[model samples]
Target: MRLFYPRGSDHEVTRLVRSDAAAVATLHREDFARPWTTTEFDELLRQNTVFGFAARVIGQPKAPLAGFVLARLAADEAEVLTIAVARAARRLGLGRALMEALLRRLHALRAETLFLEVDETNDPAVHLYRRLGFVEVARRPGYYGGGSEGKSDALVMRLDLGKAPVSR
Candidate 1:
């Protein structure tokens, strides 16, 4: 799947390509406590059940790779592996754009629900997911590690796509 913005628009989302490995790795490293290597990302791209995407500003150099979202489909469920926006790109709707794109793809794949685990202390991401209709369903203690604050709890959130309200 693909999403495009008119020329000179703020951001654009596109299907993940092998050529995106370097930029993606850079974004992930800067955004996550533990980032995936290019080879690891390549392996993920090779998986039949995985889908990935990248977001970029219209005229940015080096793509900046503002953000990316990854998910794996199983039966009727899709689990978001990770979604991260660069520090410089937060609050610009790149994360939301990537998520909307991912949701559209999951809908196309006939997914009934989406699940993810976010750091309990990540107020910004938690707010975004909640705004997107994801509800906290469970918690995993000490799910995140090696941050400035040490280990943090993980909140498992779910979005029931099967029953999601449709916009008029």
Candidate 2:
């Protein structure tokens, strides 16, 4: 699936590869308080059940990744491991595109459901998941951090593939 943007965006989504670990790790660090290391990403990429997509700028052979989504599919279910878009690239639709790509792939594999956990304080992410037809199925209090103030709750969101609204 190819989604083209007008003049402002050269971003294109593609299947992620092991070599993308370093760039993905860098992007993860920009958002998450405890980001996964490059080695960890590489190891995840090596797993048979793990797959992902990366959004990168077109027109350049070596454009740095703008965003990425990692996921694991087991049997008939799938779960988002993590997703992040570079701070500079927010609001540009890369995150949605990556997720849509994943949904398409999961549909192809006959996946029954998709699950993801997001920090409740992340309004943008929570809104995006809701827009994509995911609903809050559960919550884990204090799942995000142990900061000075308090840890944030994590919303466990689920999307039933049969009802997923992303165009096939």
**Which candidate's TM-score is highest?**
2
Model 2 whole-model lDDT (C-alpha atoms): 0.90
Please, what are the lDDT tens digits per residue for candidate 1 over residues 1-168? Answer: 347652344878888877777777877887676789988888888889988878877666465787888889989999999888888878877777778788878887788999999989989999989888999999999988865779988999999986554321
TM-score on alpha carbons, each prediction: 0.88, 0.93
Model 2 worst lDDT window (10 residues): 1-10
Candidate 1 lDDT at 118 equals: 94
Per-structure clash totals for the candidates = 0, 0
lDDT of 2 at 71: 97
User: lDDT tens string, model 2, 1-168?
Assistant: 344442357788888999999999999998888889999999999999999999888866377788999999999999999999888888888888889989989999999999999999999999999999999999999998787868999999999999998777
